[model samples]
Target chain A: MTIPDTVEAREAVDLLDRTRALVQPELRGACDTLPGPMRRVAMYHFGWEEADGTPAAGAGGKAVRPALVLAACQALGGDPDRAVRAAAAVELAHNFTLLHDDVIDEDVTRRHRPTAWTVFGTADAVLAGDAMLALAVRLLAEDPWPRSAEASARLSDCVIELCAGQQIDCAFEERPPEEVTPEECIGMATAKTGALLGASCAIGALYAGAGEREVRAMDAFGREAGLAFQFIDDLIGIWGDPERTGKPAGADLAARKKSLPVVAALASGTRAGAELAELYRGPMGAAAVARAADAVERAGGRDWAQSQAAERMSKAVGELARAVPDLGAAGGLLSLAEFVTRRNR
Target chain B: MTIPDTVEAREAVDLLDRTRALVQPELRGACDTLPGPMRRVAMYHFGWEEADGTPAAGAGGKAVRPALVLAACQALGGDPDRAVRAAAAVELAHNFTLLHDDVIDEDVTRRHRPTAWTVFGTADAVLAGDAMLALAVRLLAEDPWPRSAEASARLSDCVIELCAGQQIDCAFEERPPEEVTPEECIGMATAKTGALLGASCAIGALYAGAGEREVRAMDAFGREAGLAFQFIDDLIGIWGDPERTGKPAGADLAARKKSLPVVAALASGTRAGAELAELYRGPMGAAAVARAADAVERAGGRDWAQSQAAERMSKAVGELARAVPDLGAAGGLLSLAEFVTRRNR
Candidate 1:
């Protein structure tokens, strides 16, 4: 079923809650090993502590990457407990990217609080991000399981892909609106968003003692689902409810970000596409942002992104079936994938 | 001899040149694998290419860390050729730290050229640095040698130490002149400079199939030598031949850096120490910088650092004896260590 029933949605949220419970203790244990100054920034960045060093309720990630790791391992009949460290490693890698990306983007707020860089200053934040990445590799490399080396290698490679993705995305911002192609935009999005998600699954499969074929299929499954999630996310960037998103409508357009749907609209070769590109050339006011959103829809970017999301989700299931022949066994992974795309709906 | 004889100095140069020849090909091959944008920044950072991406005579690092690795490998009676990738990995990790450090410190020059962050902008340099760090881990993790796992883990741990060191160093800049202790400065220097150098030797030993005792001794040797080098470097930062050092005399004093010797002088509890602390309270012009330099010397910082260097070098040789008792087997390693401390003279 393309649509998640209300009960299915509840199950997905429950799975995420269970993953947070399963993964947080080990994650905290790992953070405790950081040197004092770095430990302070990292603890605050993860929302385990306030910037003042007091405990907080922790508005960190939804643990999607970690959940995917454990779910993939369980789907393959592997003990999820054995993969907890790997799950934590994946989450650390994810947060490392977030910290650096925030500094690079100069975006201040994250998880409804100030970003690490804003609270700790850019130098401490950058150093903390670097430490988190090295910590991720250390956790995997120190594992007693022989296959952990492979997982570490895979994660490092994913980190490189992420840096490239973020680099390209930043480069895109400096170029003329018409200069970027939809293909290039998609490639950047895949590198930035999908690579780590896929790596999380592949690492999970490796920990489950899966061979090359199964691991590759699991990676493909996660990548497809991740892209699907990205498409939905980009849609929300343009048309998200201000109350729900906690930002203005068309916030991405206001910033003139070369997001997926906007890139599609710019390259659509319609009158609206040309108008949208013209509007992108200057600072956007509220009226301009609203008009830009309308032009994107008229240029067919909205329809295209929606259909692509649905198509990608379909492909994701196909890949999932290849990795896990028994669909029933993959319930957790399916729930996670759906939960990510179901956010806007 | 505390000072290198003419032949000994020549031998040290030759060993470094040989290490460069052996490691450059693998390092280039590894760098060539980076994505397009990152490859450009990394190439320029390593001085392999001009900013326009044209080939240039590289003015990169002196290949000190890689030399340590190969020399330590040979000293352990292992084939140094087998450790080339690990040597390259260590160098990559070193440069990764350099790129980010330059950004954080806002230093404009490195290796007598504009730093990567200055040339390519901060975001690209940071991304390139992130990629290089991952590439370092990837290089070791991909090695078929079973011991590469231990080496990779060691390198990751070293990176974390480096981050912590840099973080603390930056924090020191924010505190009052009298707030920091010399012991804390030494700890930061050991973490920042000594940890990676020690890791290089330890990893070399691991690749050579050395046991725990030999590896620990080798690491100690590198750490002591690294601290000695740091003391000499700090002395040069304050007082050195401007022509040879490629900067003004008292460069560190002018910048108000909380380098080791400066911290020592500030904590000296003497009249000149109070005068130096007063000078540190605000920005220093040329005349003020000269006065600060005189105050530090009058506070006994210069003599303290020189004596400490000699003491650390003695300890380094003692540690080297434990790792390679034959002594003759470690000629190259010994030469490299002596050459680093001999820079001031």
Candidate 2:
């Protein structure tokens, strides 16, 4: 597909297409080494194959995390080609979380397909996820790169944070909405969503042989951008167009999810916030979902999330500038960060 | 604990106690770095603390895998001290599997206490297990040892095999009793149980700076011994004293578990084999379980398993001799191999 400069995200989209060209083979090769059952589940999860073992039009992720890795490496004047394996490893780790998260959250649809757990049994999905995680670590451990050990350690630490994020998120769901503070919600989002993105950039920087200060800055950039992306994603979850998102309107509210906006609304100290809390207390019909969405908007949740996302994007750009003073040299990283948060879906 | 020379397994018992002393601090230090929620779950699972966050006497595992690591290092004339971190990493990986297996199998008890899942919930247990897997990798990645990277790679590969073994085992549980062959059962046992033990010994050899050939031999020794250990464990599952085993008599039959002996009996071309198959078709009460056990014995499964264990033990000794040249130099490893398969439980 031709990506012209006429589109705002054309550069990022072109970079993603190129990243897929480079990293997909690595990802597929690593997954191919898994046992037959796990390989099938992983292939299906990545949209490389249908449930019947037939090839499919791969509807896998957008390769955003991998794009960050390559772009971050290139931004530091490092060869992006040398970081393809690292990029693939990050993608595998990301998908591993997705597989297990779908099981934990009981999510049915992902990337416009039935979730792996819904297609395969829960046990199979979990085991396949386990294999992917080990595969990810193995990829780094076996890398000939000088920084592979540090990359592996950082990746492992990032996954532990991701687990903590997931554990806290689950615990939050079991508690009353009014009892959960917005600060805790943001902390969870940072760990759950921001961590892998940060690790991708940090690993890329390590591959670049960047100094500690530069690596730290690159990590912060990706993390802040990731949080911004999550905020936008939460907004889309509530108010996105069904035609574009392929999700029912207010589906998160219908499930009583303690999402960023929902939690913000619950703590807004307004009558609408009380109403939103009451709605979250029991099963919700479509009408109730619409009311909850309206309540969130009236309680200043929608505005707060919008401002926070914009603030996070600015912070991300500042951190990127810290690492790459000549912004012209970091166009790809900037474009990718902007592209993730700018998506309407 | 006094370990007298007269007792058959005294040397092995002494080695395990020393291994626990050396590896427990490393294990605890790694667990201490986990996030609060995951740390709590892990501590409880390891019998380091009670469910309520108070300290408890550590009734954790017997340090069998770690003991093998140290002993293998000693057998190859290497300093066992250098491999303590690797040993701890292996133990962490093993416990990670135990946590997930309990959740998957829905087993309610572990180490005479309620399982982590039963106490905390499946979500927490699963997250905690995921954290531990990453922690295991992280420990090796952060090690200062020259061969830490290779060890990490081997451990990760072993975990992938472990997942395959577990996946196959769960698949077998869903099939008919007569459908699972004895060979398939043994293969699963090797993959599930033998792979980690093999990796442990191989890593120990690596830490010792042993050549590849010696490492391979050490791994084979551990694998054969692990298979023998499984055979003996399967026997104890059926005919051992419940008081010693901490399980009820005929428990495997009560659950209709397609264990090695059970599969061997079902595959035997005898009247008793047919009788056992018929009994396996439905839930077995106490009397039916007793009759099924008697039929397994009549079908020659007992003798076959006993002989198989002895044969594997002989192979394990041969492999050890190949690695160490002089059998006297490998007393520690030999004692460990003997101790595992010789246990009544």
Candidate 3:
């Protein structure tokens, strides 16, 4: 079916689910090379098996990153199967970051389940993440594809940026809200969230023998989409349903997280923004959490973030149109971007 | 002058010192590409800077690993300069492991100074280590050399082994000594310590345009030397002087570390070994530490480790002779093995 100009939310979700099913087997196969214990840790993290190795119908991540890889390749007139390794590699690298990020952030729950660190211990979880990274690189290096070097280099560069972004994010936690600038927050989010997504699309283009210009265009598309995704994510952090996000209601406020929306609200310099900043400075009781959430929305944070996401998504679609020219070929990619930006609303 | 058949300890030390000086510049240059904070952390870890960024003659590590890379290249009739990138790559990867291992092991001191984890916060230290790993891979991948692919692959594989070894090491800490086999200890040591050394020599040989046989032989040579290095390191953990080693006396015993010698002692099935096991089961006071040390030595753990190291050194020298086909070219490698096997003593 040729997707329409505007994909419905139901259609986008179905497309993501179908692509995830296609990608999960490749992802699992990549782990087959890992050692026994490390493989178990990865399997558990992917929700392929329970901690004790029992089969469980686990909810893996959205698989949006890998879907982007395949969709970008297809849009560039390449076979999706040829880009499978790139897709799997991007997915592995993404999960590797998540596994380590959880340990570094001391987050206990992901996908409504106990984290890998909690189940396998910190050392094993961290090592598993390391192994996955190596595997990701190996997947690209070991592939017999001609452009493997370029693909690998792009992925490595993206990972370095991811690390830098994460470093800044962790540093931000120590700074007062007044010292944290919106530009800095956006830069960190770009590096942390955008770089990988951009690389995923760029790597797909490289595999499809796309020219440098098209590759760059695809990267720009993914980057803007990634930014939009983060905007919505930050919004959800402040107001997401606990059932949908698998996190506590107002969890970001309770933790006093300086997410993008919260940063924007604090930077607004309005009365509600000042009141929200005050609420953030003190210990967050149930009342304080609810009040902080209300204050953030009242300070124009919610509206600002929603508008920012919409603007970025519009730019992302424009980039995709520029790169592929044939809008029909880009339908899958566009819908995936829509799903990512609108999820958890 | 060509090296003599028997290199005296003074000559060996001079050779190591000279090569280390040559490699340090490349090592520092490699860090130039790191982001500011990460670069600072790396500089401080290498003793190039203080925490506040002031210059210091910090005690960097011995640089033995990089020396092996250059020496192996020269010994195999390749230009040492051609192997400089490989040498720096290996050193960076070694430091990467040290940075993370210190955090995972919760080790407070290294090379007589507070470890990177203690200097930087744990989160930054971990991220810094992650950056270094990416940088290491980038170094190999960016080099336009013909063998860069093989070298990069070797390094990635070695990193996987390192992670596996670390995982096993941490898992061992949770198990009783009796449940941990000597074979497992040796396997862990081989993976944790030997894989990188093997890859170092293999990469050096690769850069030198060596054949498969020569590369494998060089890897085998370094692997044996690495085993010898670990044996001596374990011995030092048990019996080295506090003045030179910069650790508390019998620190390994006090912490009940299942180092090779300790594992060997526990598996000895001798009376002194039994006493050591009994002592290990309880909290270690100063007296208990002293007695544990005595028991390890009396149970033939110390002697067994020494003999094993000597045997491995002999085998390493044999592998070098096989690879180079001229005992004269191998003198540097032989002396390095000797230095590593006898440093603490």
Candidate 4:
């Protein structure tokens, strides 16, 4: 069941693309009843328009969560179409979080244009996010999944934890540098990023009539995958190619984001930790970010983050191994997991 | 089984007082996990503390929505405790909307204190509101109602419509005033204000094993009551006592808010409409608000709102009559509806 390399990555992407084509129209139809401005803002965020509401193409990101959902359902011996609504629900929830996250993080640009908050105002963005969250839940509820009640409940639980995780993240931002730990960072990432992905897989399995044990295993697999995904993300934040990342190199360092690598470095309590702390305490600039990045690299922070990513990747594969030992579709999932954790973009 | 008017309003207040006591601790526990500034801002919005988070007494508003939920359950022959979590869920959802509404409206004050965004910054307020919304949904999903699945689905539907309603509301604010109509305003109010209230009553009825017909009737009752509530609120917004309202009289007019009454007057295109259009076209100062209020009063806006309130109250009562004809403990519910639509405060 193990996927050997990136060959299957393109297939996974194709599956995701097909899923998006099926769901995008439905998603747009749901918003048609909304007020014009709100609908326009949502359409813009969903990559259907320019900020001025002019028609456009390609506003959405990779529909990774939905792909995982449909693949897991198929791998578990269920028709992927039966889980299409659920897949769309998870994707909508993911994008809703992204929209809010952009505003909360004060990120002005997304997908090479102004963020929703910048164009429509934060108030409008807040309402739009709320609307999308509600829509996600409704989509799940309306879908004809087996054990619909349980699946709906699972989705709601993930949303709640997602919010709590976000709260924990924002709370961490304001704390003195000493309060942040690698463990705390991981905990936040698991809740904020991992919980929904895990729930997506678990719910898909549940819909496929997977037993409780298998569901739990899939949950663990997705959670581990999410952690690995985030660890790699943290790494890329510092050292990713500008062309791939679409941001300046070392953007995380420039923003003084207390990411996994920085937390690990500080936890090491080495010379790098002292220098990192001083850099964090001061106003972060381009020069400061470069210096801090160099210091962390010199002090083994990058190596530590890489090791953590490798460890989590192994754990993710281990969980998938336990969850689905003999399924042919498992290869694609494993390959996708690897791609998620190792991709430079 | 109708409760006698001899039963004082204090009796209803006492039930809410007790429910508040039970929920306040839980709400505070959730907020405590946030950063210091966020916690303080949330506390202030909850009427728990000053802007700085110092402990204060008698700061919270009436827990009306929770009380309605509990009362509806008891009246419909269900255990109030079984509905308590849902009650808290509805209340939290209501407050979550309030927090975001304050931000969207850019109101500097709420419950006679600096608004959460004004005190904690807009980012914090948005995050806090989003967190509360997530918590509300979680409470409903986790609460072990007799029909937990149905209840969860119902709640999710309500939240989505509520968000849509808010979107419509914000959209209206930016458009040319002429583009908005009284019918559109009512539609927005029904979605934004009526949906959750209707869901609360419907959930209560569902818990009580009320058949679909009964649930539909109760939903209608709640929706009518909610519309009535808004109509009366519009009346109060222009003329209620400042001491009771915690704001100056005619605050909505002061802000040029397009409430139902104003929309009605504007749609009439009479002398009052002309005056209102003039005042709304420019910045509304104290004199303008006073003049507009006088014009509305003269042009029958106030009377028209009152008449609409009466019609809605009658419709709500009729729905209640069909839903629970025997009355029984639902006596309290009937009284609660009347009280909600008639309250001066």
Candidate 5:
């Protein structure tokens, strides 16, 4: 669990770990308000408890969004303490989507454990996700800050977009791969992955009492970084080690997921791209998954995804620079953005 | 539809219809913010449009909760104009629950029309419901009024309870009728049905700038009335004319729903109760449904539910009296409560 000795790694790990530690108690406290049965489902989903209500060490999410919230607040020369509630709210909202998405996608496992639906049931998982969303809005509204209304509105709007993204993603499953455009896929990814991250940064900046322009700049910064994060995540879905990613090898390809890299490769129209399309049209086995990964690489999907990540990293950093002119106090934000794109897993 | 010439009925219908008219535009405005597909699903669910793009004169819900909101606001000596947003927000939240409940219950019809899931599919229905909920919270938060945070928090908390209620309701379906206690059924009904109604009145009171005691009394009033509403609804579900109810005859009994009256009958411990329990242990046909209805009545379940509704009605009136001592301008709320318990269907 020790972070590397590099300055950027140390800073990124410190900020992320610190934010997770700070937000864990708040998240657990929020779950306390759920009904008895639902509380168990939510607690298990958050990796705070086992299905039997026994305490267990668990690998929760990386708490990346929360780190961005607090780091944005601090980078804006504001008291990060004032934005703790906002950070927790963002994390709660993020987990809400995760729980429901698991149900919608019918995925049985998450974070190296059975998903909440498997542990409890579909009804319980759905309700737990719903309660988590309500709790997120409640947390923001309960904060007596002057701009609580604005923050809540922003969070709700982001949630609406997230729902829209998920709807389109589900709809794409009904369409032929050729019928799914790259522009549509990218828009869905932005709405699904980028919106919440953008809202997190914007909420933090709002709590920091930043001007509108600054808050928007922070939102843009987070949106770009979130896209980079998703691009890298899509790559990891196709190529990362199963042990590190906590999923099967080439899980996205096995499922024929219309991820960015796969879509780009399909759109490339190369010989490998055509072969990959033919393979995707059939049921996938171990060999098919392996061949699919090779074809994606041969069609330049991996390179395209990698370069786009780098491009998005620069765009994100530029946004952060625009928002915070000094850049001296932005080490955490800048390192976090770099870590998002460059992390192997 | 034309209301009766009676003074009480006229006033009640006027207020309810007026509130619906006022809230309709705001609801449409809110849906405009949703994405295209989701917006269409939501609009269809709300009876604003048919499956195609053509407009349809569909029958939406009765807008009972919105009526309570506006009535409470006016009875509290506040300008109802200031509380229009709160009324619309409550209606939005109520419909959000309905859309999800239909999906969860797998009900194919609502308001004499096809349920959203049957038309658009379950995923779209669920996402549309999620969008509706987010829109509810957004409506409250977008209000510049000082109590927007309080109203939003109340709505969210009520939604949490509603989810808990639904979770228990689904769980009850897995249990035998004899195993489902009347008390448990009542608690679930309160959480599912009473909480939002209570929140509705409390929201109105908050927007009215009422004192803490007044707000609490208003909430109590709505909770009592909401229980009575459910009790009456359970009765109608079992025995109401199918044409009026827009459902099959003896729908609840045929579905083996553990409604209040049926649960009360099972808990009666009379000879007819035992016979009814025996009948309920097997699958229900038309003859069985008819026999079960007779058995329920003979076991005093029908009487018990009726008397309980009356008791709750008085309690609601008492709470309203406590909140508004004059009871002069409170005729609208009192009449609405009377109509809830007295309606045949």
Candidate 6:
């Protein structure tokens, strides 16, 4: 149960490898009863094949969430093998949100291929996502997991919170600029991004017979980790290299996305904030995007976001330290948390 | 417990009325976190308010699904009061599907008002639907009932099957006419419609500690009832008057929906079949829709669908008889089944 280092995190890698085998088959098995086009689109997203149902590879995601689940279970004196299904369930739920989020965001590409909606159409994508969520719940319900009742309840609450958070995100997009405050944005992000991560860790701990207080502490750690991850993601959305980020630099600027950094800067009331706000108020074009990025930078948005991310990362690590004293096999959990907070892409 | 006749069915109706009081507040409590516009749309769909968020009476649905759940429990000599939360959960799940389905189908109106999607936009509508689904699962998991594990598993499985059925329905829309068979259409309808109803009855029975055989029989009854209900709906989709159906006559025709009746006629090799296929090959204008409706009729699609509906209804009655010989206080359940098949709208 030795924890692997960041450079040699083969345990985490193997967990993801196992996750692909465990989850993709169940997913495909569920979709096998469906018609061809839907099966194809869903399969493609699962990284099994192409839109035409051709054999393909390297279409998988980073498996960040599942790794956290397994790692947290190990950290809490449980075998990762014992928590594999929980790990798989969390990943399935995570992907479910991604599929639907892509549709809601109207993003055509994911992981360097046409999205499920783009390939099979939006309705199919929506249903496929729904199917995945249902499968996640089913997996948790019918299993060797000792606390299926508690796990299922936790998972359902996370999902509901996730959707409510998504609704807030969508509604905020249509509102006037002043309506979205930094605190509100943080609240939305916490519910949207943090809830599932928290639930994942809590489920893992619950499976391991962790005490209620211990489970809550693990959940708090995971939640803080998730917020840190999202905060860094917001920073990366603006300032990261295009090659590393997989999209164009300043893409958030072009989309006029009010990320955490942007919101904080906008609320700062500096001259640069006024300029950034003015640029955002008008239609976002190429030149406007360039000027807006510059304005945001001058308003200290990037620095402020970086500092906030650092603070969150510190808080997350502190919580993790408080929750798991021995570390043991969960030392990998620490590495995974660092990976999430520090990753460029 | 004494069985109530249609005139005395008001007793069950009274139970439903009382249950609605509990559900409405809980439903709103779950949705309170959502932003104003999205909450407004959901409120409208919940029949709690008008599109403008103004208070309005007479906006609610019949709550038939919940009634079935409670009645099934009562029929099995279980306390209907104990099943109230689950009843609300099923109804919420039903509305969740309806909200998402409207968006996927590009439907602007439902229950003679603008759909949530049309009023609040697709993203918000989708998120709201997702929230409802999560809330439904949460309620099932949290509700204080005996046999909670079995109930949770049944609910999750039903939701998964429901999504699978929806995926097949969407996939059917994209397939060529030759590939769309009547059996396939029936399977889709079962998955989409039958699964939830079956799950509702089974869950209620399970909560009541009904024998496994009885639970299975109740599920069978629900499945057959759902098929019968859908068949009648297909018939009404074509021939029922707009005043009765609440939709324009031939509305399904204009949409070129591959419903049961249409699929049945397509399977039959006849002159009318050829004409119907030709008409469905392209968009159906008003005149073309009328022509297609006539073509289906000439091909005996109308008569064929009616016979199918009657056969299914008979089978459903037989299953219900086997499930609960006396049916006790659920005499209203039998009447509801009959009413479902006979309803014009």
Candidate number achieving the greatest lDDT relative to the actual structure: 2
Clashing pairs in 3: none
Which docking class does model 2 fall in? high
User: Interface Cα RMSD per model, in Å?
Assistant: 0.7, 0.6, 1.1, 3.4, 0.7, 2.7
Q: Which residue pairs overlap in candidate 1's backbone?
A: none
Model 2: what is its DockQ?
Answer: 0.87
Model 5 error, position B258 (Å):
1.0
Ten-residue stretch with the least lDDT total in model 2 chain A: A1-10
**Quick one: best DockQ, which candidate?**
2
- In angstroms, give how far residue B326 of model 6 lies from its true place: 3.6
TM-score of 5: 0.96
DockQ, every prediction:
0.82, 0.87, 0.62, 0.41, 0.86, 0.50
Fnat measured on candidate 1:
0.82
Give the range of the ten consecutive residues with the poorest summed lDDT in model 5 chain B.
Answer: B1-10
Considering the two chains of model 6, state its CAPRI-style docking category.
Answer: medium
Provide the TM-score of chain A alone for each candidate, in the order shown.
Answer: 0.96, 0.96, 0.93, 0.93, 0.94, 0.90
Model 5 C-alpha RMSD vs. true structure (Å) is: 1.9
lDDT of 5 by residue, B43-106 (tens): 8988889998578786456787888888888889987888888888898888888888898888
- The local distance difference test score of model 1 is 0.90
Please compute the TM-score of chain B alone for each predicted structure, in the order given: 0.96, 0.97, 0.93, 0.89, 0.95, 0.89
Which tens-of-lDDT digit does each residue in B87-196 have in candidate 2?
99999999989998898888999877999999999889998999999999999999989899999999999999999999999999889888899999999999999999
lDDT of 5 at B82: 86
Report backbone clashes per prediction: 0, 0, 0, 1, 0, 0
Tens-place lDDT digits, model 1, residues A178-219: 789989988998999989889989998998999899999999
The better-scoring model by TM-score among 1 and 2 is 2
- Recovered fraction of real interface contacts per model: 0.82, 0.87, 0.51, 0.43, 0.82, 0.59
What order do you get sorting by lDDT, best first? 2, 1, 5, 3, 4, 6
